[model samples]
Target chain A: MISPREILETINMISNENLDIRTVTLGISLRDCVHPDIEIASRQVYEKITRIACDLVKTGEEIERDFGIPIINKRIAVTPISIIGESSRGDMAQIALAMDRAAAELGVNFIGGYGALVHKGYTEGDRRLILSIPEVLARTKHVCASVNIATTKAGINMDAVAQMGFIIKQTAELTAESSSIGCAKLVVFANAPEDNPFMAGAFHGIGEPECVINVGVSGPGVVHSALKKLSPEADFSQVAELIKKTAFKITRMGQLVANEASRRLGIPFGVVDLSLAPTPVIGDSVAHILEQMGLEKCGTHGTTAALALLNDAVKKGGIMASSHVGGLSGAFIPVSEDAGMIDAVRCGALSLDKLEAMTCVCSVGLDMIPVPGDTSEHTISAIIADEAAIGVTNNKTTAVRIIPVQGKKAGDPVEFGGLLGGGVVMPVSNYSSSIFAQRGGRIPAPIHSLRN
Target chain B: MRAVITVIGTDKIGIIAGVSTILAEAGVNILDITQTTMQELFTMIMLVDISKAVVSFEHLSGRLSAKGDEMGLKIKIQHEDIFKSMHEI
Candidate 1:
């Protein structure tokens, strides 16, 4: 018999601590759906996703009701729409419409993989996909897009990097009335993982199966609650130890949920992403977990060291509990989506530069960060380049989802509502990187590439 | 299949009787049950085998919860595999 204490702890974690399955993304491959005719290809794409993911949301709800744990988002990630339209170079926007329509018909929250992988260089299809991103994202409600512009082995595609900066700026302009919200759904990556279950970066990699189920676990509140019991004088090592124990338990629940979702949906179980993803809900912020570690604020001087410890310990603890742990398996600090982060921005304790530094130690880079509307596209490219350099040189996945809010300035409030939350815009550097961005070529693979 | 049924709220008359009646009607056999008071609130944890229940898991859960509401308690029935997986190696 299970102890009442254990049962109560699980209930407390869910009811008060906000432990949950962040997403159970269904990854479906669309390679076989390609056709020379654009309408036929779109129809095939829609039919395949609708047919396969028809029960995804229902199954997720059933699991949620049966297990008594919240499953937040049921989403789908298909092969990058570029590949599906490569044969005809058809309007990728039409395919985006099809994906969004399918997501609506199936009642999934978001459909990802309206993207391309152009780390080294672009195939014609990748080019078409990249060019269509701004319009596609603006035209579709439920589609999330990503462009991987760099890799450790192949080096950074500076051309793609420059192009995406302009694309992001265009996306913001196209949806400026809505606080440039479309930019929130776009991600630019360096070494982006293929099996990531979270958006706006998740995509079905070419290596994945026909379809699979991957679950992302979130419990910053749980970690915060566990740490709340410790004495104020607990040492850094003791803090790390407690986080590991708590993380082990959190990942266990994630794996259980993942397997159950897989069994019910009849999709092969992919990895359980051992990530402590945060929500805008109070008591659920990853920043609050850092603050629970004794920091007054999340992005202060000691914040980098504290985040490094948190990120490493979470992976160490989670790897043991899960059979195959992948995805961005560490703390996510998406501004505007986390209450503590939003508060930190309001109090002027967190800034853009500090966030860039924090991303070096964390799983993802510069996520959901808002900047002045007048910020230049060249500067955005420079920001993506710096993050790409960090990811490529360190052999880790990093991404930038920076939003340059149109017609807004530093310290001005921007409201996006819902899970996106809202926060004031942060200042960007005055300097321009136009010339540097215009000098487009590949950043060759680093010295570490000679490893074999 | 097995499940963990938890009843939590203020202690009141017939709380146990109410939960037991629902289980009895649904053919759910209680494997273990324990009750305690924490912070002046009553908490009861019951481990039950629902494989022989006449109702589907969802229907049984809804019926138990509706009954719990009438009895002024918050009841949740979760599949037991969640606990076993999280607690046991």
Candidate 2:
């Protein structure tokens, strides 16, 4: 029999701490769903996704009940639509509609992969997909989109980056009535992972098998609570060690769920993403974890070093527990989705610049940020370019999911509701970057690409 | 096939008897039980073999939960592997 103490600890983590399996994402390949006629292609795409993911939610619920662990989301990701849409002659929005309809029918919360990959350059299919993203996102409720504009081997695609800046602006405007909610559903990436279980950045890479089950586990509250019991005089090394130990236990839960889900679904188990993803709920904030590390507040001077230690320790401990660790497997500091981060921003302890610097050491980049509605598209593009450069040079995954809420100014609040949460708009730099963004050519690949 | 059911609430008479009755009805055999009173709170951990349970896992959990609510307690039944995987190598 399991020890009584261990049973109580696990139960306490669930009932008190906000520990949960963030998502059980099923990746389905749509490479075989292509047809010359857009209508036929769309139908095949919808049918394939629906058939593959039909039991996803039910199975997730069953496991959640039996195991007594909350599985927050049952999601589906597919092969990037740009590849499958190459042979189709219909508008890209039609495919988005099909994906949306399939998601609704299958009862999944979000269906990712309505996206394009153009790290080096754009194919005709990639171009059409990128161009249709704004309208597609505005039209579909459950469909998520992502565009990869940079890779370590392929430099930055400035043209695509520039295009995305405008696309994000348009997406925001199109969904302005809903607090520019469309931008929240779209992600722009550098070195985007093909098997990421989290969104709005997940998409089944072409190299993945026909279908796979990937799990993303999150427990920032649990980590924070553990840290609270430690002595304040504990050094950074001690802090890192404690965090690593906590992360090992968290990742173990993910691996267990991934194996169970894979066995029950008869699909290959992909990877367990050990990300300390935070929610707006109190005690669940990654920023609070940083604060527990002796910082007066998040976004202060020592914040970056603290986050770096946290992110590194989390990965080190997680890798030892899981056979395969992938995806954005580190700390996520999305402004709106974390209560500590929101408070930090509201109290002037956190800023967009500080958040950008912190992203250099964490998982996702500049996530769930809301700037003034009047912020120029070129500025947003420049922000994406800056973040892309960081990822490209460092050879890591980074993404931007900023919402420029229309009719809102800095310090004003935009209520997106639900898990997206509400946040006060953070001010952006007033400086103009229109000239640099107007340069439409690719930034050449780094010298390291000459490895061959 | 085995689960750990935990009951936490204020100390009360007949709490163990009531829980044991529910498990017997579902054909779940109690393997071990540990009970303690810390301050005014009563915490009980029962390891039960549910391999021969007559009802579904969900149904058994629901019945136990309803019984717990009636007794002003919080009862949770979770698979044992959840603890083993977390606390054990």
DockQ of each: 0.82, 0.84
Worst window of 10 by summed lDDT in candidate 1 chain A: A87-96
lDDT tens per residue, model 2, A1-452:
66776777788788899989999999999999999999999999999998888889999998898889999999999999999898899897899999999999999989999999998999999999999999998999999999999998999999999999999999999999999999999999999998999989999998899999999999999999999999988888888999999999889999999999999989999999989999899988999999999888999999999999999999999999898989899999888999999999999999999998998999989999999998889999999999999898888888999999999999998889888988799999988999999798999878976688
DockQ of 2: 0.84
Q: What TM-score, over all chains together, does every model reach?
A: 0.99, 0.99
lDDT tens readout by residue for model 1, A1-452:
87888888899999989999899999999999998888889999999999999999999999899889999999999898888889964686888899999999999888999999999999999998888888887888999999999999999999998998899999999999899999999999999899999998999999999999999999999999999999989998899999999999999999998988899889999898989898889999999988888899988889999899999999998999999998888999899999999999999999999998998999999899889988899999999999999999999999999899999999999988888888889988898899998789999999997799
How many collisions between residues are there in candidate 1?
A: 0
Shift in Å, residue A58, candidate 2: 0.6
Please give the lDDT score at residue A139 for candidate 1. Answer: 89
lDDT of 2 at A17: 94
What are the fnat scores of the candidates, in the order listed?
0.76, 0.86
Worst 10 residues of 2 chain B by lDDT: B33-42
What is candidate 1's TM-score against the reference?
0.99
Q: Tell me how candidate 2 scores on lDDT.
A: 0.92
Chain B alone, TM-score of each model? 0.93, 0.94
